[model samples]
Target: MAVYSYSKLETFKSCPLRYKFTYIDRIKRPGEGIEAFMGKRIHEVLEKLYADLQYKKQNSLNELLADYESRWKANWHDNVNIKKEGLTQDNYFEMGRECIRAYYERYQPFNQAITLGLERKVVFFLDPEKRFQMVGYIDRLDQRPDGTYEIHDYKSSNTCPEQTDLDADEQLALYQIALKQAFTDAKDVELVWHYLVFDKEFRSKRTPEQLEDIKRTTIETIMQIEAAKEFEPSESSLCDWCDYPDLCPRRKHFYIIESLPMNEYANETGYTLVNKLAELEDKKKALVKEIDGEIVKIKEALIAYAKAEGVDVIRGATKKAKVKIEEVEKYPYAGTPERKELEALLASAGCLEDVMKASLDLGKLAKAVKSNIWSPELIAHVKKFAVRETECSVTLSKLSERDLILDEEMSY
Candidate 1:
């Protein structure tokens, strides 16, 4: 009975921990970035534009731009952080203005199709049993004279997606399912995306099979999410935009230390103590390596001196070292008669399993599995009796020297 939206499912797919924070735990953050702020403002302007058109009055380009600027200024706040470098708040404001202006000019008079609904909310079941319901808002739904429906979505982003990407869009495809339910007589439904920034429109149509496939995949994804016990944080480039970083285990320490006051951090003697300890440890490692090198040279000298003195043992001031030489035999050729005889004897004694030469090339096997040359069931069967060993190692990377310098500077 989980009702999901496109963004909810996408959030879970991006990072389960983030999804848990937003949906399950419902941890709210203060504010969003300027990009999101601008998108919201533009969406509002567009919604107003369509809403006004329903009243038989079309908003002029200048009027829409004026309204956009007014709303942008009224809603501007300190929490709207501009992430793009060298861009001010005014720059983004003007950019949104241009987007609205361009969109207004492109479809002026607003006579493309009869506006059925503006910013309309649609809900449809993804599963046959009506267990999983997906809800999303269509930016604009229009109808043609031939009973064709178009689901339009507005994108305020600067990036324009490719045709294949538009074709594979799940949001509109899911919306198409809702459209079918809402309009039973809807013969053909077309998915349209208006890239407001680029002022370009992309249209795509989905087959019934495609919608069924999307439903099946969406249900499988939901099943996986329901079956998940541990919501592990997924790291990617998108982490920079994530709002739950302070709560995430992977990023908590960074923010915690970052939030510490410079005076307080400097007053914490443990910080300096740890820094000194790390420096000493690094110096100790170098000294140890040097000492080991000298030991090797001394051992070489001792061996040569012992040979010169024609003695088997060298007596040192504190220790005695002995050099022992033993003769051993090796079979260079595995196909030799001795090796064959040993192999035959071992095979007869049922000990050949210990000496078997077959090696499991795991990398090749993985590639075969990925390429569908080997079935996962077969791999699982082989892995059923597989033994695994865990290896643990300790490593230390020195903290940034700049941070240490900054901390010292702050102390002054």
Candidate 2:
């Protein structure tokens, strides 16, 4: 038996495939793209500013951004496709500087307040069955001489929602819960969702009834995750932020490709393809649009070739068109040349042995695959879990046991 954290538990809750990719396969996500990195960089600068108040010194927003510029840099991309990725660091720094200034101009007027901790890496056990690791470098935690704890999370996202969105977010609840756990001696914990964009703020709370409602839903989510048939997506705008967009079956085209037959490739899965010749009449409108694009492109290309070669071109010319350009994709498991090549590549990369030997947890295997996301920091985060990053929600077949950790003796 091994321990699990709330994030690990939540991974199972959100999507099982992601959990497997993160935990079982031991794959790591590459650094989050530009927007995330910039937000993080700005947060670090603000954290530093608040911390510096201990020395009785304050820097203006321009000075802070200038400091970031003094150390920031940029890069370019030159990769072949499929795995091609890049970042625009100069653009990021400027955005970061702008966000920093706006946040600063809003908060600079407030008194030099008490800061509980900035950039605090807190590890607290909510319960033996629910350990959590919170990396919220809170912007500020002020004590009102009356003794109430405030939890503030910084945001740089566009389109800040109204009270309704705050009422729906689980993070504010989770953060307050974590704050309560961290300051065990404190009596009350209040949460403040601070949106640095357009200088917006909202507060949320759990009345006894509201807390019960949240509890019931959260537990239901946990149960649903434990009984899921697959790693379903959380499914929302959040999908855009996900690093594994292609892996998700929730997206429209990806779903069509996965769940439906393409063109005339029929299967015996009871999902009939072109079974109704009558349906062709219904699709005549769509067919017209398709022909206009696909057929017109070929006709235009041929006309351009005739013009370039000095051959006389004719309007409405009747020409034989190629039906297929190049379309021969092989299955992942079917014993084809493509499959064989992939198997060889996997073997060369040591992934073949891991998969063939079935030495990994199946649930986690269901979660994620990060082909190019293994950074050192991410590796550390994934290894922190006792369970593989995550497992299949519906069924957990692979169970690897760990040694029971012995407790240490106390010094008298």
Candidate 3:
């Protein structure tokens, strides 16, 4: 069995095709997103900060920032892509420095917890069978004086998520499961996230039940990946940062056309076809408006003719039109006061299920009430939601009444 990481699971969820490319085929892509590169440098610096603390040597803020800068310079490559259009390497470099500065100022002494591990590799099984093994590297693990353990993660995201999102986060919570499995003293472990860009700390913990649920769901996802025969691409906002655009079916054409000259790209078959289709669509829209006007007039004349002739059917050359006029039970539209009152009445009467298919299926409810399925009093109460309206509809059919042949001609 392959060792799964949170990142691996996330990749599969984001795009199964990408997952297959990265993990199954193990395709090597050169470029790294600038955001990820900046994050790596920050993690290395923080790891150094805690590693030094373990040696009874506390590095000053300047020393840490200097280390970060050196690492940033050493690892900087031409392939680092800045996806955001206006941002440059210098912009992200400054942002990284600011993140380090904010973190240093907020937690100066760094004595809140005892550093136990830095960039620690933890591998553990999610179940007793040990079939579904998982692996992760903790950025820092610390123990408080009160014997509570903390699994810390360093995040370099440009945007800060809400606390509710943190509560639902699975990365550190999975680490907590690993901690509990690996150590006897892991009863009270906290999941901590250092949102470096925001200079904020978000903490979360998992109940035993929650941990079990996470384990079960994670296994289910693993099984799904193992059983998948066709890894379909899932397009999202993250496609801009994806490395396999040249390989992805959805993005391959765009990737290939990206290097073409403007004139050639504009004249490309696919591009020309799309432009032509759009032009036709615009013309079709104008024509549809004119056609709809003609249809309304014809319908009104047909209804008037049917009423005058006292016949529902009107004949054309090869088609016949059947006009229907009937009283339809109309219910109050959704979100209306009358709809709400009726829903409340149904709830009180314990018949909410009869009306609710997914939401309130007003059509179903209307039929039930109109059919007198409910008591007289209840039906009377539901009447406020009901209004009768005469509706007219016209349907066209073949003029020959019982021509039940599959084809126009009989085969001998």
TM-score of each: 0.66, 0.52, 0.77
Give one digit per residue, the lDDT tens place, for model 1 in 1-412. 7789999999999999999999999998887889899999999999999898888888888888889889988998888877679999988888899888888888887888998988899998987789889999999999977878999999988888999999999999999989888788876999999998898999999999999999999988888888989999998877878897789998876566667898877656666788799999999999999998997777667656756887666544334576543332232235666556544544564544543547333344334434654345644543343344432222223445665666679899
Which predicted model would earn the best lDDT?
3
* Cand. 2 Cα-lDDT: 0.55
Please provide, for model 2 over 88-179, each residue's C-alpha lDDT reduced to its tens digit, 9 standing for 90 to 100: 45555655677777778877844634667676554443334562233334456655556766666778766678888887776656555556
lDDT of 2 at 223: 59
lDDT of each: 0.79, 0.55, 0.91
Compare candidates 1 and 2 on TM-score and give the better one: 1
- What is the RMSD of candidate 2? 30.9
Stretches of candidate 1 off by over 4 Å are: 261-412
Alpha-carbon runs more than 4 Å astray in model 2: 1-14, 74-92, 109-112, 125-139, 208-220, 223-229, 233-235, 246-412
The superposed Cα distance between candidate 3 and the true structure at residue 390, in angstroms, equals 8.6
Candidate 3: give the clashing pairs.
none
